[model samples]
Target: MLLATLAGCSLWNSGSSKPLPADLGANVAVLGVRQAWTARIGNVGTLPLDVHVAGNVVTLASADGVVAAVDARTGGDLWRATLAEPLSAGVGSDGKSAAVVLRSNALVLLESGKERWRQPLAAQVFTPPLVAGGRVFVLSADRSVAAYDGATGRKLWNQQRPGEALVLRQAGVLLAVGDTLVVGFSGRMVGLNPDNGSVRWEAPLGSSRGTNDVERLVELVGRTSRVADSICARAFQAAVGCVNVARGSTTWTQPASGAEGVHGDGDAIFGSESNGAVVAWRRSDGSRLWTTDRLKHRKLTAPLLLGRSVVVGDDTGLVHLLSRADGSPLNRVTTDGSGIAAAPVVAADTLVVVTRNGGIYGFRPD
Candidate 1:
């Protein structure tokens, strides 16, 4: 049976004997695991899709351009919006507003899945739209990135970059290092001015093949703070150099392994590589904090930090939770199919997972 919580009031299952995080407040005194609700909004796609939630409403975008918003707690439908073209992964929110990128590089804002506004980009976008710094940043296929007023669908500025061929999406996600918008593309690291779309700095990261720039960034080294500046993106490369946010030079290269999903916190670096290690390093000196080769496999998912826990999902459809301090496994959970498509989101004691099959499941600590 799926264990939800300990006894009737604790965050752990007493019989299973799992340790409870000290921060669990008295609010979520989960008893046993119960199905809050599950709604099959769309048919499973070949590639795992994700479920994006805001407040109580969750939005699901299908491969066929079907979008639906569902109640997070009740699994009830709020609204649905259909699209003509397939959508890229760059759909996100800025708390008050949620933005989506259509296949044709048009950004549409959704509130409970109802269309609010639409803005056209230079070309098709590969990354998710990020609402940050009072603007929504969308990266286009023609090596362009621009921002628009979060409320209005007006273009702010767009800058072009040297890029790879367009057959595949670019790798890397946009990383906001302090004030710089950082991303990996066309075998390089690009840091742009999110305010005006100016090229602040550039770098060459290695081996990124795709339209998904966020994933290219994941393939590169990760900075804990630089990533949180905006939302996170997927993997690709660390091909080029970025103007160090503090150094103002393009010479400082992030010499690291596989340009997977790596972000930083300005102080600590976090992410994993295909080499099968979830690693962290010091931002100032590039000193290693910890590296766990627990799941040494051909491929691995991006690693993220949950509180002090280092969480990594592997291709085998299992997510391993480790202590960020030592890279030791703390807890582990397995999904029915492929490990996890999108990175997992946490809601209190529950670990929210959106699988490739469009199944959103919540796992409580045992």
Candidate 2:
């Protein structure tokens, strides 16, 4: 399906008989946008490299294996590092430390522009390395989860599960909630002890219904953003549900058809559907509030809550702003022709986004 291809494998180049749709031009404008600065990371081809914001620094990585940290306010380069091999997934960080998964199935940890340690991984990683609790957690393409010592890069514990042959290549999320590390893997949300990788609780968020393997594949989409007391997540065409972080019980379940995942703004849950539709639901009861089809057929990234609007990028380097209250189109903007591949990050007063063509842009909404 189209959702499977949105997992960063260039849906535009898919061998399918259907052709990709073109992005719509700027139409309605309500909110004003002021671009602060634009920077280049590297050429965007296939590998997953994202922009991560921690405190005042935004870290970015490129396919050619160049990593840099830029000042969120002025887009000034704070530090830069180059890897020997191409990067697969994006970068992850705890503000103080950062991690990246290499094309050689290796994990590299960086801090203060220096390589702290490097460790070989058994399987190829499609998800970003998570740094938390003095450990680095990684979810590999083989459906394996491993934790390593943050300083020494020593393998501490690992867990593996059966994976489908054709799995979604999009990066799933690893969240740290209290003492447990919540991991989104193959249609399931798992809570594991950060110290030992033991399963404390698990919730089935997706089900296999397709006769073919690709249709049957169910994986988490974007990073799990916290909404009130619950943690909400979306599965690739499987389901989107929220669970209490403390009890690990489902709060609600809805059919998930998005490749880019979901976002929440304290009051409402927003998601970009596979059909290019944007929908908002009540965070309290998962009640549908509004849906907009203006961006239909456009490959949209995950929704980003900015001010009172929901911002999302499309396949043609277009950024859309929708009302968080009713999902109405408020404004739209275009990037440097390279479509945005990663979710927009909020850093203080500006919004940051990265395009597949290696363009990073900062916009200040006015």
Candidate 3:
């Protein structure tokens, strides 16, 4: 299976010998960021766990099926739950309810840190379940989407598309734009009617090209940047583009070799290339604004636009803060030395990052 092959290969490294991580020069502390509080969860290992932020709460899960909601402002535990089976994907929440997928292909729903109900799925899920508008949406590896009542476990609807020969084992795009449920199917950004799981519109961001399935893979990744009606996402290692969800048309697409997703503000979109170069592009025309290779060879997560800085975490347990205007270093912070497990998220004025060793650190401006 493609999943097994992907699991063993490094998306960023193609050669036999891995390159050394870039050297980080002396810390020139420009931005004033301080660790506010630290908490612990079960080790995340390699699971594609997403840190979900809603209001002041940060919802996350560990590979061992331990899910918890923490107050980003105070680092206080709001609620925590442990599922019977280890999780394959998770930490999706709507503040009131949470959902996750077990390794056994079961969808579990929780409310107030208690399991509400469970439903069985036909395929493996890597993307976190999306909980929105009293419904929980699950996107599986088999190119299928299913919806269920958030309050109950009753299945509402299921929509299956033609399965591709291979699909990425990481998180793919699935979000809500106004009243439509926007999802990623291969290289396309599709808008679906949330009420009935029907297709509303489709916009292609990447297309198959190479001879083999692996080279032709262009699944859209998550951690997308959404500014009002404009949603920008990365199509695996193929390209980055933005779509007008309201008009159901693609605005622009620029070829970019990146395996991770992207994040941006109103004027610019930022992404980390597979080579670890940080790039900023004009959101309107997809033109290059600036590129920095100082952090090249360091595996980076999808960037987060925080205030005047772009925040990115690397495999060395370092969170880098760079200038939004020029991609220059502004500040850097250290975690538990186990590397960041997911992209950084902001909540209640606190910047939260999770480590692979299960350390959750909350930072605030000093």
Candidate 4:
């Protein structure tokens, strides 16, 4: 899908992008080789904290206050929008539309390149607005979740309440399960009504104590032949669970090493445990079928499952391809030596991810 934005050149500035250079000996992402196209974007003195890609359009925001829409295939420039206020992470669509956090304490929509609408925020608007049902759903830093009319940008209904004790700086996804709007925060989960900002439910997530266990697990697993080849040594043996969005009930809980990346498709809920444990549970009973212990990085960028494998990026800049069936190794690739900050997205069967180094890579298994 081709997206057209405001074509004026006055509203944007360009910045330089630090090059990945090249790593000749790396098994993957051999620097300097197989370069599709590289372009330098300048305008903000800060890095874009958020990235999103869909159909032929990929959108992201920079701290320097510029929003960029680039061609997914060729890295061609599509449109750019610079707001006076600081920008937030890219969210709202499955990757089609983008939303930013504004300095005025509001969340605004940036589509193609046009200003869709600007809605008032209660306190610090942190979570990326959820764009669906002709409205945008945003969870403010203060705990109130509001939904605004998508087309006319009118306030529908907002319910206010105290927010969590703290919101995690690490990024998490939002879900609109029926009328329950859920935001996964650090150590807790809050659910709000999408049409009206009312508390539907809240679930408490546990605290992660040790951050260095990842390296230890990797070393321990490496010493054990079967465990080393199957599970990364830095395996997480922490609590992992999901809460209900309607009544704030702690529906089910299990020990996980890290926050599992969660996905709620209509029929099933999908995500991975901190130690690379993958499970697909029936939405009705949360029962599981097959499992795998292949993912090893400690970061929380959720896994994106494709055909026979689940694709994940880690803190070491290595992209591991593990089989989705029982969690066996398929292949791994390296596009950059820098670690990945965001989760990988599925473009058909091809996987795409933007690294912390400010470069985007699209890959397919041979």
Pick the lDDT winner.
3
- Write model 1 residue lDDT over 1-366, tens digit each, in one string: 111111111111135544332231123222223334455544334322334556666655665566776556656667767765677643466545667777665788876566778876657655566677768777655557777886677888877765534323322355456777876555556677777777766554355544653332223223223432222222233321233445444433344544345544545657675456577766555566777666554245556666666666555566667676787666666565644555555544455655555666655554
How do all models score by TM-score? 0.69, 0.93, 0.97, 0.65
lDDT of 2 by residue, 219-242 (tens): 886766696558888987767788
Order of quality (lDDT) = 3, 2, 1, 4
What local distance difference test score does each model get?
0.54, 0.80, 0.90, 0.52
Question: What does candidate 4's lDDT look like per residue over 1-366, in tens digits?
Answer: 111111111112123643232232324322112334443333222232435556776666555456777776766778878775665444456455567777567777767778888776656644456777667776555445567777777888876654224343323445556655665443456666676666655565454455542222210000000111110111123344445443466555544444434443434444655444566554444466556544532333456656656566765677666655555566667656666656676543446666665566766544
Ranking the candidates on TM-score from highest down gives 3, 2, 1, 4
lDDT of each residue in 1-366, candidate 3, tens digit only: 234225312755877898887788899989999999999988998888889999999999999999999999899899999885788898789998989999999999999899999999888999999999999999998888899998788889998887457888788899988899999998999999999999999999999888886777768988899999999999988899999999999999999998888999889999999888999999998999999998998889999999999999998899999999999999999999898989999999999999999999999899
Model 3 TM: 0.97
TM-score, predicted candidate 1 vs. hidden true structure: 0.69
| Top of the candidates by TM-score | 3
lDDT winner between candidates 3 and 4: 3
Candidate 2, 133: how far from true, in Å? 1.7
- Over 4 Å off, model 4: 1-56, 71-74, 94-97, 119-122, 152-154, 178-180, 184-191, 199-238, 242-251, 263-300
Q: Least accurate stretch of 10 residues (summed lDDT) in model 3?
A: 1-10
Per-candidate total of colliding backbone pairs: 60, 0, 0, 27
